[model samples]
Target: MPDAARPSPNCQSSHNAADPILVPGRTCWRMEKADRVAVIIDAAAYFARIKAAILNARHTVMLIGWDFDTRIKLEPDDPMPGVPNELGDFLSWIVRVRPELTINVLKWDLAILKMPFRGGTPLVLLDWISSRRLRFRLDSAHPPGACHHQKIAIIDDALAFCGGIDMTTDRWDTPDHRDGDPRRVRPNGEAYGPFHDVTTAVDGAAARALGELARERWHRATGEMLIPPPPVPAFWPDDLEPDFRDLPVAIARTDPMADHEGTQKTGKRGVREIEALYLAAIAAARDFIYLESQYFASQKIVGAIIDRLSEPDGPEVVVINPERTPAWVEEESMGSARSLLLQRLHETVANPRFRILAPVTEGGEGIYVHAKVLVVDDRLLRVGSSNINNRSQGLDTECDLAIECAPGERPEVCRSIRSVRTRLMAEHLGVSVEEVERTEEATGSLTATVDRLIRPAGRSLRPLEPQPLTETERRLVEERLLDPDRPEPMAATILRGATVFGDVNRTAWRIGAGVAAAAVVGVGLALLARRNGLGKKMQGE
Candidate 1:
């Protein structure tokens, strides 16, 4: 980690030729200085640190995510005796005790469908109605079939967290990720599989910038402008250790251009800073690129990787993904897209310069890899909610925090970047950090080190072999109906009609229109399947 005492004048200077990849308005929204920054691995540590920071918040607490369940306990394994353990109860208790504090939560509106199943969430929200300071709003300010997928939390505009870990059920898991851990259970006591995720926490100017971003999102969703809270003392967790200090963090976003009901749309064009950042970062890799994402189905990203591998001295690439999505529908769509991309990679790259792997438990159960992280050599590190998928590139609302280590500047930052990679590799391989470092030093190749460490048994990274795609699956991947890179024009047209036309039976009309649209899409897909003989294959003919 970089020393706190070291001065970073070059990073603090105005944007110029020093910073290349994190250019504002192109690859990022803004660049701001951070007093301290830490990459919180897994939800266990993330939840605990967030709880601590919120407790210290004096004015505001903003929680934005794809989903939020008040039923889940923040620290199920290690609970405090007097303090509230459940998330809803914890927030409620804070507002009541503080009196002057306000808590605002914004979640994807579609996630409300699951609220009835989330025990105590409705009751908790009902209780919150008594206090005007505690507010909850659903975010539907997105295009049809798009979602607000960024997970973020801001505390008094002094500290903020942005990343893939959502404050919901089945996300809490320690780095150990032991098989059948009793603590890995839902609020209803049902055991869930081990999950791996990451989030970055920052303080100072970067946190303030994130706060502005969160406020903007809230205004768009609820049509209520929020003022920034007065600057407060640092709320850094007592037990947490920062990975970098005195560094400049770039904020990148992916926001689709869509018209909301009550708010003025920003413009015709959408923000694709996240996509630009990914392409530039991938192209700038010198030695290797290490990626950890939930899915690998983006055509642009895959094309960039292919371009790099085609180079004679291109950087080696290593990707980690889940063996397959847990849900059947996602497995068929995203999983099939992955298989096709992998086949293309294999066919184009002559030498073995790239590999995709999945993490496994000691019992050989596949651990879900939900962390969206990218590390290019030892110069750049990105951690956030953006996944390597088509939707994340341009359709979904996403945010990612990136830090770059310029050549001949801040060697400590470079070391910290390298440490992040080694630490993650150690956790996945079930080995100590020292062991990973030693092996990598001995081998002098990241891919070679991984190949040497992975064994036939115990917890290890298993190389994922792409499944042979059937004709139906191949058509699905090529069509990309499930993972379109932009808003579906048909769906958008229907939405605009519902908004522009007034009717007494507005709800019914909207529902009927949605059904008609779905039917049209479904019929087209059915025809495709029939043409491919999928119907007969499914019927066992």
Candidate 2:
């Protein structure tokens, strides 16, 4: 991975930070100071840091994600002599080495259906059951159509990770994003495409706050309230340097709750802090806004962007997304929605300063972007598991970490955020960090810099032109058939689908559509859980 040089401590930007964008109760759940925070750019670096942190755990380690594949290799490129490379073996080995340490793994209950196909995972789970120190559980606390989508890890209440990268197969890829890297293969020895992702690591009170969140989730899923581990010295990786030091990190969440019956529910009520933060951040932008997400189909977010673009002096905007959703069903749903939204943006803006682009490797293979990140002109930085999709807004569970800079405060935080944006652009454009910074300085626009730097051949950022959607696709997107904004009862969902297709109920194809809708609500919940290729069967490899 190429390291972007941090700005000098004395360096500052002309655009002084604006008023705080991360507001408690409105934009975030809480704010806590982190002793150190590092943004791990991709899964390879994140996996390595996680391995080191977990190994340093003195008491408890919690793994929470949409899916978990014990067969996936950690640090495959740089394995330690005599140390386990696969995740399951490593966890077992760590517990045995540190008798005081107890590790717990929690994954969405729907993912259990994929366990049989995952190499050696069944045996690994059996082995985990045999060890008293290692425990695994499935999370089914969500409503029928919703799934637990937060990818998080907490170690000893000292260090924590929260973001889009899951500790599962096909997620490990270096920043270089080499198109044919042999290491980018599954445990079954099948190769996958280049992948891009982002996550943040924090140590201090911030980590402890995340620990509380993780514990709450575990309690909700299993009805087992685990006590917080005693606070200990920070166990951040020795070699890793934090992007921001002694900064306040805000925690944002999306927890959907079903309509209650006559009695009160023990679980917490639904919160839409993530959506609020996105809106607040967008509304707060002055110079520019940069976003990278798995899907760009959120109507609320698109409307926010359109509102900004309609302004005479609105900030320039840039987005990074995959060339196309990897799965066919996802393509028809989220993909079509993305197309519709992009079309609206193009139509609404007269002088377009916004550009949505997809990253590709030197060999021209699309790099699957699974990172959910938002940076608003160095005033705020958000990195987490929530995508710009309806499900993430209020239907599914999510968690995001954000750092905000008040006007004339924390020059270092501002510089760090700028550095992260440049680093991401540099990676996508196949250029050096210095080159990106220089171009941005000259163009005075991130989108313009992208336009100036984009190439026709080698690794480049290609503008994503909206595809023409068929009548069916348009209806699917407009009706929000597959991506409802809130927790929906299964019966209501089916009936709604039936009503939508009732006109053609006699047609054989319409019957197939009904079955597809049923499947999406049933087993298809797994596919909707995460768009990072973990949900469905691999098409070829």
Candidate 3:
């Protein structure tokens, strides 16, 4: 693997502070009250909020996502009189009901193209674009081989949602994550894994900024300018009431433009912003660092945490991921890398203050972890589209909101955020928050919880046992590592090279060959256009 030490221009001097000193009573930042922010805990809440925003939109609706399934129902069981249940039907109804309103949708072109069986069906969206006042486009051209992986929705420039959640089937789940709940429906009647995710809703200036982001995406996708939507009426759902008012929120966004011109200047890769933000938050942490992410494969971050753990006064670090990667490739590539990284960290920290956990229901259905959140010292909080993985930081465009809590302000808001994380841990361990807290208080940190549940009798720490991989799984993992665009190319190349000729080798070879062929085709097309009159025309010669 590449020496995880590539000099990052985004790296700043770490502020090795012990804990965040509470700022005096509710120091209101220059942000507006209408510019409030609320964290949506799971996919269900995310979709419900988007549905509400769309329904309440007075002038415009804009959406951008890495993946979107029109077949997915926004309101699975809500008996609302006029609400459309499924996404496609709901969108169509919105156009029909509000003919004058403009709506735009943009999705990653590759993701759309991946579903070849649905060929020309995107024409349905194109037709909607043509027939109604709606506009739909597919975005493909980002940094070469990179993806536009942001998920956002802006309604009439009055409300916006930004996060890791995608509006696809199998994503909706309540916080309860009840085992084998018949109420949860999979499109093909196949049972899906339990999952968790988070998104943010913001109004006021921050909302308008998100609208700008949607407009920028639309322009990149279609070369068409988007006009800002007119202001809309306050339509906050009764269920989404603010946990605390007058909270100070910071709207932090990531884009290629910033990389190309901003202070960090990590080139077309926006991972630097995500990394810098994470490291800065880590240094700023005082009490503890609580995070929930789909994957953990960044060794640099693990190193940083190890450094912190070496400090006697450092805050605790907690991570939640699925027990195993869902696919063979992930298991081999990210799963193995994470396993090794965690072991290294564990070895460095004598007491093992850091932890990685997976949530499971009583019935043994593995929770598909997808939430992207960070709570630092109970003062700094973030919820957004980026994961902790390498792809999210470097190869994909992501956006997140980071907020600093005002001292003596609604401390309950901070408590609420902590409660959510603790509650998740409780669900996984089948223990109560009070119990976890009591144990932590007695033992000094989360290590006690892990030691109690995971360790064998008379053992202080559990042995670093790797998940078993089948031959097919091993081959898939090898292939993922060989891919340069993946997060850990060095590890992938080494591991995959060793098993590239095994029984599962053909499958890996085919996939690699396909990606290479696509890259050739893309480059050939670009060169041909440049040589012909097409490029000149595109350049407006």
lDDT of 1 by residue, 1-541 (tens): 0111122222221223245877888888889999999999999999889988888889999999999889888998788788899999899898989999999888876666576787668778656534468877666667766778999999999999999999999899999999999989999999999899999999999999999888888877766779999878776989999999998999998888632221236665678888888888877876798999999988778777777777777778999999999976577668988988887777667548898999999999999999999998878899999988888988899989999998878899999999998999999998989999999999999899999999899999999987997655665566565676777677664554444333435433444455466556645544553344322222221
Clashing pairs in 3: 1-490, 19-286, 271-393, 481-492
lDDT of 2 by residue, 1-541 (tens): 0010111222122222345678788788889999899999999999988988887889999999999898888998888788798998899898888999999888887877678798678888866644557877677677776878999999998999999999999899999999789999999999999999999999899999898888877766656678888868666798888899998899998888522111115464678889989987877788798999999988877777777777778789899999999877678778988888877777657546888999999999999999999999877899999999888998898999999877788787889999988899999999999999999889888778999999999999988988998766776677677777787666887777666565563442554465566566556544443343332212342
Q: What is the C-alpha lDDT of each candidate?
A: 0.81, 0.82, 0.63
Candidate 3: regions farther than 4 A off: 1-35, 117-123, 257-271, 406-413, 430-444, 449-511, 514-541
lDDT of 1 at 324: 92
Better of 1 and 3 by lDDT: 1
Model 2 CA lDDT for position 528? 44
Model 3, 1-541: lDDT tens digits are 2334222334322564533322211111123334466777777777877887787778988888887777677867673576778787788788888877777777776565443344344556646545436655566546555667788888888777888888876799877777776647765566677777778887777677777767766765566666786666656655786543455455444454343222234334432456666766766666677777877766555556666666777777777777776775556567766665565565556645676666666665667788888887667777787776666655567777666665566677777666655655565566677876677668765656655655232212223344554454444433434223333333444455555544546655664566567666665554543344221222431
Q: Who wins the TM-score comparison? A: 2
- What lDDT does candidate 1 reach at residue 306? 73
C-alpha TM-score for every candidate:
0.87, 0.90, 0.79
lDDT of model number 2: 0.82
Off by over 4 Å in 2: 1-18, 258-269, 503-541
Q: Can you give the lDDT of residue 2 in candidate 1?
A: 14
